[model samples]
Target: MCGTIDLYYALTNKEEAKGILPNLRFVKETNRRDLHDYIMWHNINHLTKFLSKKYEDAYTPVLKVNNRENDNDLIWKKCLKMIPDFLQIPLSSLYLRYNIDPRDKIRVEEMADIIRDTYVKSFRQNAWMDEITKNNSIYKVHDMKFKIGYPQYILDPTEVDKDYEGKMEELPSHICYNQPSMGKRNRAYLFGAIGSIISYFISHSFNHPNREFKRNGVWESWLSNKSLEESFKELQNCYRDQYSKYWINDQQVDGIETIDANIADNSGIFMALQALKNRRDMNNVRYTSNSNITEDQLFFLAYAQARCSNETVTPPPTSPYKYRVNGVVSNLKEFSDAFSCSRGDPMNPPKKCTYWDF
Candidate 1:
């Protein structure tokens, strides 16, 4: 029931720019929204079919359903669960399936407690960062404003709708053709979109802070879970110490300085958590926030609970996210401080945590 059309419009035959591919049938049959949806469907179907063939080798192996009635179901579920692990999809995207009932504001406040206990304490224990850097890092956490829930402006439907207004619906055919692969691809896209949106909000949060800092002509920056890369780059030229050279992998053809930011991000979050924990313990702060205990423990539990499942496609043998978190944290003095581990704890093992100073 599908046919291709090659339509041409004659405006003085040779004297014409190009005519648009008018969806004449759509114009004749459907409403504006319906027509847009129809167009989107066709485009997606066309794309999936093209991709399925183009990357046939890559996907075909994953798509083969082992068995309909047996343990195959388990495998399918396992694969779906593993998506976040392999893809490193953000927590926001992964949460879409299960409704996160709005946490009690009391519980939400515990985030600050968790920050103080686990994250902050760990940072203070870090032997790597110098005293000045450690103190400044602590100050940053204390000064950080936690914006829970959607921003104040986004609560307005008009503004929210405008931000997401133009989404087109893909046709049923598109879904049917690429149902197997669509989930992963769509999830990936969702993460990317969310990342961009988050970056925007993080940027906005800094506008006022930057303006005030600018009065003194001093640049101020806010760190997010996502801005670890830029922060490292900022650190690059500012200090060149003995440890900086250690960060440069001697075996790597790419300069040690060129290591992926993910390593630094893992290191930073771990540091932040440790430092927060130290502050909490020394001050006897029971919560992760400015308030007391309401939900601080729950915030720390979230990390353990969030450990994603492994991939269905037997991932290249060893891509463990938890290990990455642990590996970097072990070398940090702040982590040991927050956890109060001796010089040789299993998880927070010792490493020459040297950062480049020059």
Candidate 2:
């Protein structure tokens, strides 16, 4: 039975993947000399070290807020990121060696497993989403690919280097930004930095725009229940109102502007907590009781610290770091429970707006 259904989806999803194939498909890099031409345009010798080492580092490290006043450094970092598009293979090789490794996948994949399974439970509980959409969401989660670390072919740099012979064969774009999004500093703080941040990002693909795309990457509606759309809108409005009510940098948050992120933030937090809950002894993420923090609370601390920045609050596309931490935790009853907040307290609001609470 499972095999037959898989076959049917494969047949149906081909067209969807095919439609975008023209855009995503890469051609022989040896044939495309524009990249080389672009490189010669720059100070190639001066950038050699940057390209070889520092450029890759800028991308993999935990994101830091731009509090520094060095405009030149920012420009240099910006240039480093752009160069990867031109130096695909060389940079991929460098990235494989230092940024992340195949071994990192085992632990991160375990994290993905915990989050994905928790998402399944959330789907099962969503009464507003019809059976078809919910089931399809679950299916999509099951089928979701974790493009961990780098491409396997890159492991043999000499062999792939010979094959490319100085041209661009773009690896799948999906894997470009997937660094080792987990930290090893503390066990309880496992999700504190990289884990929940990446988990949040992965869940966003299933949120707004990518939500329209199927497990097969097709842009088609699977909302078997028509009212699901309206319900979603209402839920979005709740986020808008909720975030708007908060103040940031002496300016009010335009919930309308940050709605997508807010929605992702909401679901992401829920998923992170649920994922954390699923871990066996939370994988024994280490923390001494001297800190007076529980293992579960440490996860939230890690989650916030990953988003921590030194810059002042900025306007949306994202809420200020403060709101991203407090605004979110305020609505989570689990957060309240984790900290033993009294009802109606600031962090423990009387009313909550969790996505999967239903």
Candidate 3:
């Protein structure tokens, strides 16, 4: 019954599910027990019952895919549990061996300063936020801590080795070949620094008086201004309407579920781009190369590339990779300006859905 239904579904929905076929085939070919076990134990019973009842005549064809057992399957399954420890030991060892540190402390510190400065500037200039809230936001930015790269202690061989003292023999043979470099370290630092700034702002919004809070461990509305509250609702509604248009698996994405990630994606890219622009402006840097693209364009391109993925079979609850790039960039005036996109252009719509004032 399972085989018949599987073949029927694969044949009937082949076009609609084209992107997922390779994954299905890979699973079958590789004989992944974990995936097979999950499907058989959790999903197969319910799924088969539904299909058999719904389409009794659907069992016209049978799947011809070969399913051969691999000798290394047991070893692979065992290794999965130890993967974290296996990877971490070598990674930490490499970091220690090379004495990994922030590639450019001055540059990182400057970027951090720029990000904080930009946040404070946005807070001061925002008309929506009241004086008290804006002041509190600026204070938070000032107090925000920046832990850019690996801690200094990680560079010490003794300290790092102590973490895997008894499990030295468990270190895989692949560990000797793995080495950490400055590029990876720099990228990690950039992500960590940006992530910290973004997280702080997100937490600040929730705790803001404009939203609400608890006075006696019970939730209550602290927003005194009716106009501000209405504006907030309007902004939220705009986001909901905008995001609801996107479909995943034939179902519309819930805007509220995607709000947090959407906010992070949009704000993270914006803040990073702003920092880059600030740095370029301060350094008197101009696009001198004959690449026919400006630094601003490159900035957006880099951001999009970082998030690029073949989101063939993502669940409806999460925003697709393409949407993450498009949805965020479309609302960004800087992106439109950089590319000189027309008002009605897909990437530069005249009307944009915005949740954050910045």
Residue 236: error of model 1 in Å?
Answer: 8.9
- Measured against the true structure, the TM-scores of the candidates, in listed sequence, are 0.32, 0.68, 0.60
Ranking by TM-score: 2, 3, 1
Clashes of each: 52, 7, 0
Tens-digit lDDT track for model 1 on 150-184? 33333234543444454323111110111122222
lDDT of each: 0.37, 0.69, 0.57
How many backbone overlaps does candidate 2 show?
A: 7
Cα deviation at 278, candidate 1, in Å, is: 7.7
Residue range 1-358, candidate 2, lDDT tens digits:
3333333233236675354423432322333475345445443433443563465465333223434232245657877867767666667666766676465666666777777788888888887887898988888888877765556777577856764674535454545445444454554466555566656776787667777887788777556556887887777888888888988567898889998888778777777777766664556544467777887788788778777898667777888878888888888877788889999898887767766743
User: Which model, 1 or 3, shows the larger lDDT?
Assistant: 3
lDDT of 2 at 127: 78
Q: Write the residue-wise lDDT of candidate 3 on 1-358 in tens digits.
A: 3354463355346473474556565545665666556545444533432343234234222111224322233545745756555567556556445663444444555666777776776777767778765665566557667554444444557766765667333333222322244354333234333433444354344433423642332354434467767865676676667677877678677777766556656666666665565556677765454577666666667567666687743554457877877887898898899788999998898788754454
- Which candidate number maximizes TM-score? 2
